[model samples]
Target chain A: MSGFIICFLIGLGGSLVYLLRRKKSVKEISLFVTFSLLGFIVWLSIFLGYKVSPDRFFGWIIDSIGL
Target chain B: MENARISGWQFFLLSLNFIVGTAFFVRPGSIIAVSKQDGWIVPLIAGIFAVLIACLWLTLASRNPGLSIVQICTKVAGKYFGGFIALLYIWFFIQLAGWVTRNLGDFMKTILMPRTPISVFHLMFLIVVCYAVIKGVETIARTIEFLAPLVVLIVVVIYLFTLSEWKWERFEPMFQVSTWQLIKDSLPVIGFPYMEAVTLMMLVPYVKSRVKTGLLLGITVATLLISGIVFVTIGVLGVTRTSHFAYPLYIIVQELQIAEFIEHVESTIVIVWLIWIFIKLCISYHCAVTGICQLFRVSDRTWIAIPLVLFISGIAILTHENIVDNIAVDTRYIFQYTSLYGIVLPVLLLFLTWIRRFRKGESGGSA
Candidate 1:
């Protein structure tokens, strides 16, 4: 969890630096932050505590599609 | 940008090399595991599906002449939505690069270097791939065009030597599996090696002319080559034995014996396979870096190559517990994930683009 948190913070800071450096729009910054958080949360869920079984996730999709 | 443009043959070779990448060595075991003796049929069916998907992708790509898929997404959808989609593709490309890196590392550790850790191999591969990415796509394309023929020649020689051992009787009771089973198993083949040409969407803009025709031909040639490989594997090893081995093609090459001498040519085959894998890694890494540059409005992407290589190599090393887990994850879940991005996303994008264009045409006609 600590590792993920640090990685997320680093990414967030990097995004800000990029936005400033490129002179991008506020909307772009917001989009970046939103997507970064979204990705980080999912990644955290996968890597943080109990590992999510990729098989189960995929099996559910296969069953949902009736395949 | 003008200097970056590649000739049509270079474009064709790039696509061909990308399509017949690491998957050639890694896929046969899984395909045979599913389709049994009829595993060769999987590539045939997947080839047709790939051609159709390629045609649709080409149409969408040609509609926006100079833009890669990332730019096309931004144009078709508004900025935020397109940015989100483009990011997904960038992640996908980077992840694929990592996966291929890990695969090569695993193969080397298993077969050649038992004592060396896999990360060492990954780092070495990533360094070369980073160098290629920095050299730009034109260099990468020309590199593949110049070397692909020699690689093909080596593969042909390997095939000829192995032909003496092929048992036609081994293919007995073909298509024993039910139609549903065949189709279900074929999905992985389609989603993986075939639809993976979708990555070419990011490279199509670099081609000088007849972009659609170039893509179709490249894909066709790749599909044919893949089909030939699967067929040879099944014929030489038989379906059961082929599926039983971890690396069927590698094992088959190891088993090759010509007349009396000229045996144990597996090392030569490995060299050719490594070259193919290297080209594959470069294209994936290039696409990821280029996509990120376009996404972030970065004028020069080469400066970020080392950082990206570190991130990718770290992920590749840390992703799965081991090679067994890696293969399991790939065979079980990859098709589902790939379907979403490779098939569903492109189909939806094409449909939306068509509708938008039709409405504009209607409005103009009314005016």
Candidate 2:
């Protein structure tokens, strides 16, 4: 778990630094940060044994529609 | 957006690779499982429907030249509604990228490196794909154009090498499946590689010319090749065993023992499939990134590419529990899910365009 966090932080920090150095627009940087953070949360949840399967969610939707 | 213009030949290869995609490895078993001995016919049926769907997409695209499906959505449906529609497509493309990524990870873990974590495969592959996508579509078009012939050559070679195992008797109990059954079973096939070719709509405007001929030929040739692969698979592995294995083509290659020295070549074949899947993922990832850029009016795809790759890897890991669950969801829900983008939306857009054109003609006539 510690290893995973360190690796995630490295990736996040590396990309953030790269984007900053390039002087991207605010909207672009924010969008990147938002997506990166969302990705972090998702992987963290999975690491913590809390997987939210999209296939099941989709299956439920299909069942509800009687397809 | 990057002023990238691919030639008609590159467009043809792109369409062909996109349709074949991961379907080459993952889809055949399910198709065979459903259609039984006559499974080879499913691609033909699905290809016919796919051509019809492609017609809808082409007509819509030709009428509004140089505009991608995303731009067309915003143009035809007005800003608010069209933006919403475009958003749905972006999600679809992302979801598809997730699936393709997961498929690669699953295949790698199950077959090649059982000890390594599936996440490793997913992350590594996505990072490479992200790089290609960031480089722009011309890079991708050129890369695939170079790789496409090698893929074809390898497939043809595999077909040739496996001919010694072919048996005509395997097809003896043919046409036993009723036409209705064949069509019904082919729905998932259509929804999959065929309808999924709607992703090519994202690339149609990139081609310099001959969009119609190139697109149709790509679909036609891919369909024929895939049908031939399934036909050969059924002949070699027979219906019962072919339907059972998860990667039947892999199994066929594994069993290929020419002169007793040319053996265990499945690993080499896996490399070829890796190229195919890479091209497929790149196109979907490209479309998703492009869609986001166009929809949001974002100028640079570079910043967005890395972030989206991370999100896609997360979705890939979260999408399914295992291969069985993956296949089950696909068989049950994929057709209906994809039809919204592939069939319903294109038809609706074409109809609306016709209606608007007619109204304009009427006003002009009155004037």
Candidate 3:
């Protein structure tokens, strides 16, 4: 939750700054920011200590259908 | 030809995102499972040995200042043969996307939507990734730069969040894996995630500036440093447990229960991994589509994205019968061919261009 807040603040700050002088397309900025938030979210979860495996039955189903 | 496309920072950071994904979440855990708790040695080996491969990429990019890897291949290898090589690379990238999709889908389904059909999940991912591809590499690079800092901050916060999980003695007896085995294992680790930066060769000519080379290299190195943080993860979680998870990093976040009241934070992790895989898939899919378009001499590549997405979805389905097979098979191939195509071939290209340049002198001009 705290990480999410921080990400929002940072993103807001970025949005404000970009809103000032730059004229890059909204689509471009939105796409970039979306990816940025995504990256942050990913790192946040990993840092929080996520576990990964593909051996359990669910992992098996996922790999079979999607991998 | 003269368009100053992606900035050096943008290209480097985007390329770095590739390294930062599923590998960071799972590598240290995976290595420790295979080689035991001594996995802290993997990142160092990855960092130190990867320079050679990176330098080879620089050589290739420097030779043809304005040509993409595909165009350069055409000039160097000639029309028919070069097109064939490019097609092979396209195939490699499609396979790469398939592997990423499976890894991501397996993680998401197991952790986020326990009852949802994995195919539905993959189709959703394919839609987002294909849309991003249609937007072009500039969109991708810009996306990465803006995301890199947030990613760092988020991970740092999470690190602090899970600081209690950091068991000190887990890292004891670090050298137990033997130098040979550590180095050997690290090769595959680096090859798949780190060394694969060589794929950025395709984007070199597209950089906004060549002077940003050093900065680009820095971004890439730091990306691996983020991977080094995984060693901290393995130390905290215990390698034996982490390897057992398909989405180890997801589980890591799921473990973060603040004050014991705010628990089950897996949704945040799921969203993030989904985005990472989406971006990875987008970039690889873009590369594949563009590579194929160049091979077939198609005018506009955007039209091919949908059909290609369908084909990729098919390949994703066929990649494995189960998560166990997918990981075992995909990891092995990613380790092997990612190196061959990503590092070795580019190095070989550099040598070939070097010799040809030497023979032709300034007239050839490394082109």
- Among the numbered candidates, top TM-score falls to 2
**What TM-score does model 2 achieve against the real structure?**
0.95
lDDT of 3 at A47: 47
Per-residue accuracy of model 2 over B1-367 as CA lDDT, tens digit each: 7689999989988998888888888877888888878999999998998888898899999888999999999988889999999998998899899999999999999999999999899989999999999998999999998887788788888999999999999887888999999999989888888888888899887889999988999999889988888899999999899878999999999999888788998987898899998999999999999998898888899878888877899899999989999988889888998999999999888887888789889999999
TM-score of candidate 1 relative to the true fold: 0.85
Q: What share of the reference contacts survives in each candidate?
A: 0.05, 0.66, 0.00
For model 1, how does the per-residue alpha-carbon lDDT over A1-67 read when each residue is reduced to its tens digit? 6875887698679868976798876645665565456445545554555444434555677778875
List ranges where model 3 is wrong by over 4 Å: A1-67, B1-4, B210-226, B330-333, B362-367
lDDT (10s digit) by residue, model 1, range B1-367:
3248888888888888888887788888888877878888777777788888887787788676788888888788769988888888887887778778888988999889989987789878898888989889988988898888889998899888889888888888876988777777777777777776778888877878877777788788887888788889988998878878778999999999877887898998898889888988888889887887788776555555656656676667655767688777767777777876787777777777887799899999999
- Candidate 3 lDDT over B195-290, as tens digits, reads 655556666667767524643565357545655666766767877787776656667788788887998876766656565676677778877767
| Model 1 whole-model lDDT (C-alpha atoms) | 0.79
Q: List the candidates ranked by lDDT, beginning with the highest.
A: 2, 1, 3
- Provide DockQ values for all models, in the order shown: 0.13, 0.70, 0.02
The stretch of ten residues in a row with the least summed lDDT in candidate 1 chain B is B298-307
- In candidate 2, the second chain superimposes onto the true chain B with a TM-score of 0.97
Ranking by TM-score: 2, 1, 3
RMSD of each: 4.5, 1.8, 12.3
Ranking by DockQ: 2, 1, 3
- DockQ for model 1? 0.13
Docking class for model 1 is: incorrect
Each candidate's clash count: 0, 0, 21
